[model samples]
Target: MFRTVVMIFFACVAGVATAEDTRLKRLDTGDDSRGWEAVGRLDIGGKGFCTGALIAPDLVLTAAHCLYDSLSGAQINHEEIEFLAGWRNGRASAYRWVRRAVVHPEYVYNGKVSADRVRNDVALLELHHPIRNTTVVPFATDQRPKKGDRIGVVSYARERSEAPSMQEACRVMARQSGMLIMSCEADFGSSGAPVFSFQDGVPRIVSVVSAKAEVAGHKVSLGTQLEGPLAVLKAALAQGQGAFSAAPAPRENRITVGTRNSSSGAKFIKN
Candidate 1:
């Protein structure tokens, strides 16, 4: 299938991450209007890459594969890894770093038993100190949006196709797939960008950027499917963040983690 599976979420399937596409609409990246913050500035062999986010003062989330590299079919060294927070405008707030990172043990990047086959492209990062100004983690339940819901994307992407830049808002064309409808595009540096949906005057992060764009290139945006797989993720995420503190989704809301209704006009993508 030519899919690049990441080992954080799915078990094992070869070639399951990318499709054959690329031409996606770009969102405006003028000034990170949505206040998208980059997770870290990596010096990977003198080259930089993107990483997780501090949705709360102490809880950080990102694609598990980024830290471990379970998809390139390559071996990675873990001891020399580092994480930085509040990375923006070429100057990090000067006070952000990760004390510990726990990659999902079952994570797979490429062709191992723990292959990056499913693109289980998400993870939780715990910080040494809680971010001062950061409040509650702004994470929404892991679920795909309805076919035509309005959504937002915030990520630390490489600008000019070659530098780390953050994207604030981009209309998610389809609720679950297809292409994004903005210029604030993403790149290798923009994995794990939180995708939020606007509802009841609040923007809730319903998904995270998952796989690489399909070959058609419209920029396929895969939101997290919270209904079934989050049990493992929740437990994995709670190892240090205490508990997932998301408010119980409104009863009228049917897209919650464990529910059996879709009358609210909100539906969940199957896991």
Candidate 2:
């Protein structure tokens, strides 16, 4: 199913290819991860994890599918989620429990792969308390990158879950149906990883990893465009939709509660 999707995307866009992509560098040391403190790990229910970034002191940006149970297709309790900001070598710069979460209204976790799924695969998380550490700052979002634009990804995956890895040079291979196909390295647990565009030497998030895929034997990552779906997610949060809390009684103050893949032999998998 994912192979078909990748093939279709390749056919739709001409000259879809990666150029001089760099190898992944493990950010195992403090100095190696200095400016990327905002990119952190989302530990969910002690079952699995995903990558996420602080877009605001109290808000996190990640893929919508990260909020659901892959087996039950049910939304996970927000209280079970924790954000480990700048986690490395068994310690974190700051730790906070999730207070609320909002998935994109158009995203549906039906356990199927499709363009619609990838296009709307975004979510926003609100922390119980804002991260106020001077070293851990939130990143700003930017418009989606164009095809062939250079980008970078910082993420934690299955075998490398202890720390994040940085892929500093990758290209946007194509843009289709509001999704980006890029040469960035992604794997299981990399879902919700931020795709960064360095403008004026300042890194800004432009997309969020939705899945991992292989097209004609080359590995690629899938992501959602931030500009439109992100606006929708923020609006949903403002409108008080899909909010969850662990409190015994719902608080009158309506602020929080919260809460890919591959292509195969030419296939697709949610990271």
Candidate 3:
């Protein structure tokens, strides 16, 4: 039973690829980033980047693993973080520093990869200022996606860091133990990428990419089920736990969480 369970759970890094493209299309132009302005790059202390989405004018949601160091297991200072909305070719619709960040308490940084870990691999970031640009409107989030539900993803990954990409036809393969197995291709730096369901004809975040894995030779993506973990993180932020309030620790050059090794040769920081 344990072997079977493990087999069912250990899938791999999948990127956001559409049926039409079979690979992610870079949103390198204003036209490409049109409705995806809110999906931006979370530049972490100039060390690495992760994909994040603005859920509110001041709140960015991403994978919890983006908050820690993969080598030292230390929490990355929120002050060193910046959000570049609609980042494209050295430009952005808006830029803001992070004021506070809260990871799910249950999320163990640098912990072993597993379904339980993936389920809790979510975080919320509060920006120092709210982005009020008309073009960078925040996105709405909804309930988790069901099995086989068609979904979409927007993210930034290695070699594609200058801009984001959109994969409009990924599918949810299964849901088990609070983790989502998706057909979407998630590469390194894709951690915290939002999984959207277009059930209502409008995009709504349904999950946050946690890791990528492979099962039975089929590549797949892993993500955290959002609603519950998001709520917990919100409450934690309200209580001022883990918020960036003091001077950050001395900086050390190391691989950022979620960018180490995966199908795309990218790290999976959400673990």
Kindly list the per-residue Cα lDDT of model 1 for residues 113-186, writing each as its tens digit: 11122234456655557766542233445455564455665555555222234333444443221222222345
Candidate 1 vs 2: which has more lDDT: 2
Top candidate on TM-score is 2
Cα lDDT listed for each candidate: 0.43, 0.79, 0.77
Candidate 3: where is the Cα deviation over 4 Å?
Answer: 1-21, 245-271
lDDT of 3 by residue, 1-271 (tens): 0001122323332333434444678887778789999999999998788999999999999988887766666788889999998899999889999998887767765445655467888999999999999888899999998887888899998888888988887788777768888888777788889899997699999999887766444566788989988889888878887666443323323333344322222223222
> What number of backbone clashes does candidate 1 have, counting pairs of residues 3 or more apart or in separate chains?
35
Deviation in Å, model 2, residue 209 alpha carbon: 0.3
Model 2 over residues 1-271: C-alpha lDDT tens digits? 0111232235544445555747999999989999888899999988889999999999999988888776666788988999999989799999999888888767766765566677788999989999999899899999999988889999988888889999979988878767888888688889999999998888999999988766656777888879988888788878876567332321123111121232311223333
Whole-model lDDT, candidate 1? 0.43
Clashes of each: 35, 24, 21
**Candidate 3: TM-score?**
0.83
Q: Compute the lDDT of residue 9 as modeled in candidate 1.
A: 22
Error of 3 at 53 (Å): 0.2
